[model samples]
Target chain A: MTSLSTDAIPHAQSYRGLVARRLAILVGLAAVLVLSVAVDVSLGPARYALGDVLRTIVAPGAADLQMRVVIWDIRMPMALLAVTVGASLSLAGAQMQTILANPLASPFTLGLSAAASFGAALAMVLGVAIFPAAVGLMVPINAFAMAMAASLLIFGLSTLRGVTVETIVLLGIALVFSFNAALALLQYFASDQALSAVVFWTMGSLTKATWGKVAITAAILALCTPLFARRAWALTAIRLGEARAAAMGVPVRRLRLEALVLVSVLAAVPVSFVGTIGFIGIVGPHVARLLLGEDQRFFLPGAMLSGAVILSATSVLSKALLPGAVLPIGIITALVGVPFFAALILTKGRKAW
Target chain B: MVSLALEQVGARYGRREILSDATCAPVAGGGLTALVGANAAGKSTLFRRIAGQLRGPGIVRLEGAAPHDLRYMPQDTGMSAALTVYESVILALKQGGGGWRLSAAELAAVDDVLHRFGLADLAQRQLPELSGGQRQSVSIAQTLVSQPKVVLMDEPTSALDLFRQYEILEALRRYAEETGAVVILALHDLNQVMRACATTLALAEGRIIAAGPTLEVLTPEMISRLYGIDSRVERCSRGCPMMIVDGPSGQARAG
Candidate 1:
């Protein structure tokens, strides 16, 4: 009996250790995000010292006119926008993967990106905006509207069919292919200038980052974070299986609908601002799972921080890659993400999910 | 003692009725009851209705506990491959406790369950890394760790070897006796049902064929009527009733 009691001690201690380790990883990811933001703000055409950037940020009006404008007007919004979009897309991806019960599922996998692109293409090619807004804002509004439309379509269909994961996935895939084909048709008939504009919109750059865009994305994130956090336990239970989650009193259909609406908002807002920044939504959650397993309490925040870190790092690298011009943020993400994703599959892919 | 009473329970899938007006004796606490039936006999459908997974016409009432206190374990053993055994048990406890953090007592209960199920060594192992039998054991441990007032298991011993099956059934019987929880198992094996259960509810084509003590209701004629087989219920040298299937019934063979 004494030996048996001794055997049980390590199990409890190990669980505590697991919790500590997850916390440490979350803290470490937050630090990486902060560091990446610092690097992103410092590196540009006119370089600013890290100390100066920190000082300027701390006391915005105290810095010299040039320094303040560079830090506050130009670089700060871009860095903040990267963090917001990254975290939003990643959290959405994490919830999507769980609710769908598919590791490959992401914010874009359900045709949100395709729908957003189609809407943007319509604005650029046919000069048709959903609302009569300024040219700078009209495309994004249309794109966001179209993405939500796709979400509503999918949600309505799944509801009619009883809201199973299989139904959602199959219907989402059908939408993806249909939207992609429509996008192709639009690009085929466009004039040279319109076609170029459409192509650029799909390339997904951070060059369009502004304080207004940053605020919008940040506001959306703020509103959605608490909602997601409240459902974190139910999301964790969902990782077991939908039936099991329902058995545990999770109200599975309602949970899926709530998650779907949130994911649509998360994916749409970012795609509207930054274009189609792919791979982070899918890869960020996988990286978090590799680090912290499937406990949603940690997994959700871990995915958000991992995404913020990756996108901020990529934003810095995109500027550095070209001497005077910024490389497209989407290209850098894929270049970096694909290799890392491939390596993850080779090493831990078989058992990680 | 707590008890579960079902009255005129009926279930259907689409337009086809699976269970029609099925009723059973009030299963009292501190006793292990076996629900035995052949294939497509609505055994699982009935269990689902009791588990609240299916919306059927019935009044499933508990004598002394709330509806939330009843726990059901499905036969599929839907364990998450990503969660370790310890984490899975913790998730179960959190679900039962309805809290974010586990108290010291709750954590100790999880550890005790893991140790009792011989899963202490594999507590840190991912669930998918274990064999089917090991996963089943972990599933059972997860159910028990919740400390439910009533426990329902569907084919809980289907994946176990003979010794492990006996061990698991014995452990469940002991737990029911100690906690006075109404324990019900949907089983197919006659000998296992007779040995492990004090009461038996035999189902046939969605109707109750017999409901009484295991030894009394599980006679040769009842077995034949339920399963279309020629069988005998006799006492073994250890004085436990055993089932011996002689052959198929004449009508069954002709059909």
Candidate 2:
């Protein structure tokens, strides 16, 4: 008979240490986010001192009126939007990877972004909108609707075939190609001015960041975080494969459907508001998985924070690169993300889950 | 004592009948029972039906334990490459109602199971890094850590070396005896069944042809009929029965 021994005490202690280390990483990510927000807010056409920016943030009415407007009305919303979009995309990507059990799967890889772009193109070029009236609002609404449509299509196909990970991923790839072709067709027949609008929208920007968009994205993220957290253990179980997870008493089909819907919401909202910011969805989760292993309790939040940090930092870089011309946030993300992704692949990606 | 009873258990996959009218004598807890059959004899389908994974017409009644107390391990271990052996075992415990965090006692119990399976040294290693036999052992450790009342395993020793297979079977037999759990395994090794299992279930063409004590049910005629091979049943030096196959019989030899 095996006896209860003190040997397990060290394991408990190490487990606690792992939790503490993950928390520290989270704190460090939060610090990066705060610093990026500060830097992004301070740099622009009219440079505001960091002290003045801080002062205006502390008490909005006390600072100079123009300075307050610049910090609060303009830059603050954009920076906060960066955080929201980043966190949402990252968390959604992490969920997708776990549920699909493929390390390479993400919202972008699965064609959600491409489908959203098609919807936005349709709204901008043809005036075909999901939400009529209010010209500026139609793009986000149409984009969100199309993204959800793509997710549903994938989900429906997988259900017909018993919801295997390979089926979902294969169908997602097919959706990506189909949507991209549709997007190309739209661009080919558009007027020059409309074509340029469609092109700029596809490039992705934070220039349209406003309080309304921020509020909507933040609300979606806030509402979905707890739902995802409640299913954290089940999501972790899914990494063991669907059959194994089902045998472990997890309702595999229901969990997969719920997680797919949540990921669509998480991905669609941000893409609607800010166009398609690509790499944060894939890279954020990889970074988090590298730092904190596959424990969903920490990995989920770590992914969100990592995405937030990457996007917020990119937001700062987008403006700081040139004096008055802001680089496209999507372009900057790709440029930065490509090298980092390559380096990760060469270094830690082989062994990473 | 607890027992498991199945009445008229049948299964099919898209009109291909895998099992039909397969009934078992009530197997009491605290012993190893072996389900032995040929390649296409529906051993896995029957096991899945018992594990509640496959839905079919059946009445699987447990005398003293709830259905939730039964755990099934399929032929494929399905261990996640991302999770270490210890984390996977803990995940299994937590999934089985151990709550959000593992208590000290739970951790110790997991450690004891790992040690029993000779997996304590590889506890921190990822599942993909281990050899097949080691991975299978870890999977068994994951199942046993939950301390279920009924354990069903499909080809649990399929990947292990001969000595390791013997070791794992011995540990499982001891575990069943100590906890009074009903342990059922789908096995191919006739020698293992003869040595380790208290009861033997012989199946052919989706039906149970014979079921009783291992020595009594596994006769020379049953072996020849089940496998289409002429075989001699003899007693080993230790007085346990063993089967030695002579050759293919009748139509098989003509072909």
Candidate 3:
């Protein structure tokens, strides 16, 4: 029989130390995210001082009325929207990478955002509503509906008898191309007004972010975080491989389905609200993976924080890159995400994935 | 009192039946059982059948152990996860129902298994950085950290060096003896099987040809039938039993 030894103290301490170190890294990411959000809020056409914005946020009634209105009513929603949407998309991508066992798998790459864009373009160009009851809120509702449909399609295909991960990824790419082609066809038949609206919507902007949208996205992120946290060990075990995870008493198929369903909602809600901010879904989880590894406990939160930081920083860049005009956030994200992703791949090489 | 008995346990991938009617005696716990077979002889298929990953026709009966108490480590060494050795072992240990936090007992269990498997020094090394032999040892640690009552490991020592393989097999034997686990490991090295395993199960072409004590189940005729190779069972200068391979059996001819 193996008994507890004096050396056990050191090993346990070392492990505890490692855990503390990871948690500290998470705290650092959260700090960076907070600073990014603050900087994101401080920038805009009005150009409020950072100190005034913080004071207005801390004590709304005592601050200047104009600054209060600008910071809390307008800028705060946009900034928080970036945070929630970023966290949602990143968590969705992280879990997608986990369940599908493909590092390239993400809400954007798997055609959910493309499907949402198609849905939104249909509403803008053809005045078509996927869900008739929500006709007044046609664009976002239709986007949510079509995104769910696409996610469910992928989920259903994944549950088939013999479909592999590569097959799912290939199917997603096919969906992306098919939806983009269909969207182009719709744009071709549209009025100039409708066409311009469709084009701008595809560009992806945080300028139209509202408090209601922020609340809905934040609520969804809150709902999904605990569910992913509860299965943290199982999700981490899955990275070892499906067979090993199943052998460890993890219901692999069920877990994957559940996670896919959650990922579907997570990706669907944010893309519906924010149009098509696509890069966070692909890059956020990878950043978290590079830093925190895939221990879902840390990786989950790390992904959310990293995504929030990246997107909030992107939002700030969108406003800061030009003097008064807000550049399309999508262009900035892609421009930034590609170089950062490439740098990570080049530096870490094949080890990080 | 833990025991594992397979009655007509069969598995298939689509239409190709890999294992068929593989019945064996109730192998008792507290010792090593070697599963010896050729490359295409359905050793992994049998383990998958028993592990319940594949289903066709089978009755995998266990005594004094629940299905939940079983753990199967497949013969895969391509673990490319970014988790370190300690984290990977802890991941296995906390599967099924652990909460967010790790308890002291859990940490002790992981530490004990790592040290037992000679993986303590490499505890902080990431999985992708390890060599094939080191990866196999890490796999062994991951498999046993949970302290399952029944264990199935396919080709567990295939990638290990000679000394590491021997040491791991000995550690597994001791682990089985201490915990009374029904441990079955698929191994290609028959000499290692003879040295460590108390019971031997011979599989050939999806059939369980024999199951008995290592010496009784492994013979010149049985070796020939299993691998299409002519071999001799002899003793080394240290009086340890060893398999001496001569050549391919007369039944097999290379084209």
> Using lDDT as the measure, which candidate wins?
3
Q: Candidate 1 residues B1-255, lDDT tens each? A: 889988989899988899988887688989799998888898888878888888889788788878888888878875654778898888877775455565666678889888877788899998768888998998888788877888888889999999999988988998899889999999999999999999999888787778989988888888877888899888889998899899988654211
lDDT of 2 by residue, A57-110 (tens): 999889989998889999999999999999999999999998888888999878
lDDT (tens digit, per residue) of candidate 3 on A26-140: 9999999898999988998997778888999999999988889999999999999999999999999999999888888898778898999999998998899887887889999
- TM-scores for all predictions: 0.96, 0.94, 0.95
Categorize the docking of model 2: acceptable
Q: Specify the poorest-scoring 10-residue window by lDDT in model 2 chain A.
A: A1-10
Error of 1 at B119 (Å): 1.8
Model 2's interface RMSD: 4.5
Q: Output the better candidate (1/2) by DockQ.
A: 1
Against the true structure, candidate 3 reaches a TM-score of 0.95
How does residue B122 of candidate 3 score in lDDT? 92
- Considering just the first chain, candidate 2 attains a TM-score of 0.95
Candidate 2 global CA lDDT score: 0.84
Write down the C-alpha DockQ for each prediction. 0.46, 0.41, 0.54
> Which 10-residue window of candidate 1 chain A scores lowest in summed lDDT?
A1-10
Lowest lDDT sum, 10 consecutive residues, model 2 chain B, at B246-255
